[model samples]
Target: MQRRKVTLKLYPNAAQSARLEAWTRLHCELYNAALEERIDAWHKARKSISYYDQQNVLPQIKADRPELNELGSHALQQTLRRLDLAFQLFFRRVKAGQTPGFPRFKAAKRFAGFAYPDSAGWRLMQHGGSGATLRIGTGEAAMSIRARGRHRFGVEAKPNDITLTRRNGQWFVSVTLRVPESACARRRTGDQRRGVDFGINDWATFDDGRTIDNPRWLREELPRLAALQRQRARKKGSLRFKRLGRRIARLHERIGNLRRDFVHKETTRMVRQCAILATEQLAPKTMSRSARGTVDAPGRRVRQKAGLNREILSAGFGMVHPMLAYKAEEAGTRLHLSNTRQIKPSQRCSACWELVPKTLSQRMHVCPCGHTAPRDRNSALVVLIDAFNTQHTPGTGVAARPKPLPRQRGKSKSVTRETPTTAPLGA
Candidate 1:
């Protein structure tokens, strides 16, 4: 499935805003009530209630309460559907050993209405303009308009939730669109495979020894950002403080936009170049703990590392792999997830086939057997070898094998050694 998201700046008149607020409240109420009903049913029968069953009751309820018709029957039904979906997700997570709490009532600042694929509650007011019109309630008081992007297409806007959010004194609506799966299939396909290593020193390392250095804009701007924040705090709610707050927010926005741009460009380039891509499965929360420094210089190093880690996270190293997987599928390419631990791509010698243990600070690969190369390049070669072996192995397991020491011409042969050990690779 292909999904498109468009965020529009909403301009709602005072009356329209009030009506939208009421609709949001009603939607939230229906959602909570539906959730309560499902929980009661599940408690009684010990079986999950299906979304369709809950949806089927919407029309009857709408008919019984004619007053809710003005709030948009389609919207109310969509809210119920979302509530059902939320419960389904929570149940799934609980089964996976996750602590997923029950769905709770939506609060005002966090409230949003919904529209389904089959609902008529949502429509595109203007097909092409600075902004499009959206009708939330029956009356004109609920009508709102928003700006449009430069690109105008004849594609019809499917009924979906328009989430209203207030950020930086601006009202915005996140519009979700369902597009044909073929839309993102324009990428090229290739047979080459790749492995990626993510690091704080270098944002990412390819099997080919290429490294994308982290920009660390936040680290660079931290002093200015801290100063502005301090100024804002000292000034409190005064006009000067508000102005400083806006400045700080804008600085953050700038850094975020830059990071996003960099990730998009880098991921697109990598995806277009290789068909099959592999990367380490990283847990950001676990990784962040190691980023702190010693007690002596705790704050300095911790802040610096944290800033760098944040940039790496925002760069979407983890997200890029999944995106490439689906994008590769659309492009008729195969994307594989390889076991990085067993691979030991970084520690293995590519030329001499010896295990070369090195610290993170070592940027060059120097073998005692007279082989030398860039660390990242050597790691990449090791990854390629692992991939080749994985494809050739009969079973799914990554069995260990002795490293083939480099042969020397005219030298005497020595006795060989053999050892059986557990495989290093695990998915």
Candidate 2:
């Protein structure tokens, strides 16, 4: 079985929308109250409250607050579970010597969503390919929300979990479904492998020289976004400021949606065609680090570096490789992640296997062996080589193909190679 999440945009009448807002506000209040209780318990008695301690008090809570009876008991419990998970994460981070960002009370505006741990509280209907109908709670008082989305979950989609979220004044319900792998299978006889290099100028450059141009969505929208910010600053705390804030949120939402759509389409196509997908393991956080140094020392071209960082992030370098990985998994294809530190793809010449280091400004990779290509494309070629090398010799790249166990299937064949499967780095 495989898990897939489907998000549908919800359309509700004024009455239903108003009720949803009230319910959302209640959920936010509950979250804040629980947070305050935990803090006070620690400060007053030097005691920590567990999830079970709070959960045991839910019935009394619902009894005292009659309005909460409208929501299912399961959902209210899950909200407490969510808070427990946050504290768990905080502790884990502290143990690992990382900053422990203590869980804080959520403001109503920031608390955008809540989830149903199971399918008991909600039911979804997909009558056609274009849209869906979602009913939350039970009986006639239940809210029926008309939603728009083409449901995709192979042959059959079995909803296991659901969440209702509001983003940019739009309501959306996300359903997590369990699907059978056999039902979703699409057979392909492809035996080819391709390496991809992601960048700022071009979205992706395949080892074979094919390129996808970066749309630079954030860059294109920056002028209007900046103008809106300036106007909002001028009208701060006024009604106009709130309206402008909505506009800015909507614009950001649109850019993110379009980028995700583009990524899904492109990745689906690539996964379908290639048998093995090899990509560089890029650390986007490290690459896009701020150039503004501390007070002791300053950095040069701060604005230019910041712009470059934004461009890199806007290119979806972080999103693409992960999408490729999961899509490849679904397609039963191999995904190779070459280590950037060891492979040094950008510095190595793909043609001659020689180190030809170049700076960020050098867009063309020129090698003494007469190999010349776009910097990103050449790096992609090196990644391809490392992938093939790792296939024969593991540990050469980030995640090499796993060696099959002898007992699981049968005895391993004793076929031997006469020469080296692939040349060494310096050879």
Candidate 3:
């Protein structure tokens, strides 16, 4: 799906800027008022208030106060939509066992300007030099930079008040445009299927024994980040402190960009090479919660787990899987999400079917049956096997058995008991 986002450099004159701010404030007021009314009605009648009821009354209210009409009917409609979204979120949270509360008024620090339906076509007045004239209402405002490169044109501009705002000295503008989709013909040549295991020490391991190391960029940058934060905290509300805060925010943004770039590259490479790709469905949030601990009295195991989670999230494993799936479809490749819940891929030996008890610290899969391999690679092999079974003989009810491992080499021979069945791989 194609999506478009346009950022405009607005240069509204003083009078126009004030008008725009006033319009935004009025929009926020109408939104909060509608929300309060709905909440009060729900409290008194024990029933959900509908958006239709609010929309039906808005036009009459605007007619009584003609000044409200200047804020644009479409802008008021957008506010109602926002209120509806808020109410939906509240009910969803309540249904999920969370505390629900009334929607609050929009504060200045977080205020967003209004949106209006396109009716009158807006004009971008091209001018000489490095700037352009943006005509809004009866006035023309000159911007410092011209819209060039692949920047979107044909945006129906609204009143200056609907443009961006300067918050804490940073400027922003919002413009909407329709994006056209470009199709590419799919070409398929690969005949192999690949299974990937995502981990902490390594970003991904394939069944073919290839591995990608975890960059751990966040961990590496933590020391510098902590130092900057400490310095900023010491300055309190000073200008230097704000600058440092901005620097820290920029650093985070940079790291996020880099991580996203890496994930896209890796996912694209895999999708292009394999005819079928299989991977486990991991819950990053749950994994993160299980890894929290104090640094001074930190549990190595928990810290390691947390590190793995950070790596997984940074690599965008969850996002990459879906992206790869869609890209593969576009490329005539098949993407399969293996039923990790039924297979003990990590513990079950891929070759001899022995049960190998392994801790997170263990990097090697060494079975007493003389089968030795890298832990992730071995796990990937089992994942591939599971994928094959799922594709070929699904519901045949042939379960994997964890056989006893043979005696350790150069050690006394002892009887090994078969391990009990545990929860499946991805689960």
Please, what is the TM-score per model? 0.69, 0.90, 0.70
- At residue 283, what lDDT does model 3 achieve? 60
| Local distance difference test values of all predictions, in order | 0.62, 0.80, 0.64
Q: Judge candidate 2 against the unseen true structure and give its global Cα lDDT, from 0 to 1.
A: 0.80
Candidate 1 — what's its lDDT?
A: 0.62
Candidate 1 lDDT tens digits, 287-340:
555455678855556676765567666555655665555555555543444454
| TM accuracy, model 3 | 0.70
Candidate maximizing TM-score: 2
The TM-score obtained by model 2 is: 0.90
lDDT per residue (tens digit) for residues 295-357 in model 3: 776556776676666666776666766567656765666555554444556776878766788
What's the CA RMSD for each of the models? Answer: 8.5, 7.0, 9.3
Candidate 3: worst-modelled 10 consecutive residues by lDDT: 414-423
Indicate the worst ten consecutive residues by lDDT in candidate 2. 414-423
Among residues 3 or more apart in sequence or in different chains, the pairs in candidate 3 whose N, CA or C atoms overlap within 3 Å are 20-161
For model 1, the stretches where C-alpha displacement exceeds 4 angstroms are 1-19, 29-67, 89-97, 112-119, 125-144, 150-182, 187-196, 207-209, 235-254, 275-278, 290-311, 388-427
In model 2, which runs have C-alpha deviations exceeding 4 angstroms? Answer: 186-191, 393-395, 398-427
What is the lDDT, from 0 to 100, of the residue 16 in candidate 1? 62
